[model samples]
Target: MIDKILNIKELNYASSLNGDNLKQKIEDLFERPAISFFGNFTSQTEFAAYDKLSVISWYVPNFKRKSAYLKGEILKSGKGTLIKLNIRPNTMLSVASIVSVLVGIIILIAAGSSTRFLIVGSFFILVGILYYSFGIFSRNRLRTNFEKTLDLHKV
Candidate 1:
């Protein structure tokens, strides 16, 4: 039992090293504001197929934190990527809304007298509205978080 535990611990350490190395490489390649870390944490009681799996999950936060630092460095270096990550969700929401609107129009034309078609169309409209609203909310949240981070660093 003790041997098994030791092996698991070693595996976890090795897995963490791999993640750290990968993050370091990304930082080196991006060279500043182009990177941001993302982390995931699990309850202590959670068990995975292997120790390595658990380590990767735990290491995500560290990677994200480092990425945030990288972002700052890039901002200071003035060599950061022009691309922004937060816009994708909004773009996706817009596309989905357009598609939903088109589908609703098609259903209205095809159904003629069927109430079910109306119901379906309304459902799609509702979904599209919710998607757009959620996207806006997400954008606001990201902005708020970024502001908070900047404030913290300022102090």
Candidate 2:
């Protein structure tokens, strides 16, 4: 039964699910082939004080042969909240960029004041910045293409 469903040309044939239901459905499909989920949570605090609030908590899944899925919740603290859309590669790239940036910062800080060490440290920082920016750009372009493909299928 699963194989037959998988072989079909159209996987997202059912359009009734949206929001939370859609999220659940995608999560349920993770056991299948060539699919994985990426989870992220972001919080914001006012004035760097004790009032910390979770702004977004969500998961995005990218499938090998199907449209990528977005599933998550947004906490409405003010005017409104937004669920992250069109984010799969973007999430991965953002993670990569963050890791690279942190490493670069640490290296540069440790190098401190020495001319030779400063040169090497600066190189690392430059490389990190390049990698981070490239990753972000690639992710955004990939996401846009994926979204276009999804829209095409819906028609």
Question: In lDDT terms, which candidate is top?
Answer: 2
Per-residue CA lDDT of candidate 2, range 1-155, in tens? 52221211221222333445444443444333432233333333100000011112353354122122233232232333323332322233344455666776777788778777777767767766665565444444444443343232331
Model 1, position 86: C-alpha lDDT score = 19
- The lDDT per prediction is 0.36, 0.38
Error at 86, model 2, angstroms? 4.9
Q: What global local distance difference test value does model 1 have?
A: 0.36
Shift of residue 9 alpha carbon in model 1, Å: 45
Model 2 ranges with Cα > 4 A deviation: 1-86, 90-93, 150-155
The 10-residue segment of model 2 with minimum total lDDT is 45-54
TM-score of 2: 0.37
Give one digit per residue, the lDDT tens place, for model 1 in 25-67.
3334333343232322122212111011111234444332111
State residue 105's C-alpha deviation in candidate 2, in Å: 2.2
After aligning candidate 2 to the native by TM-score, how far in Å is the CA of 35 from where it should be?
19
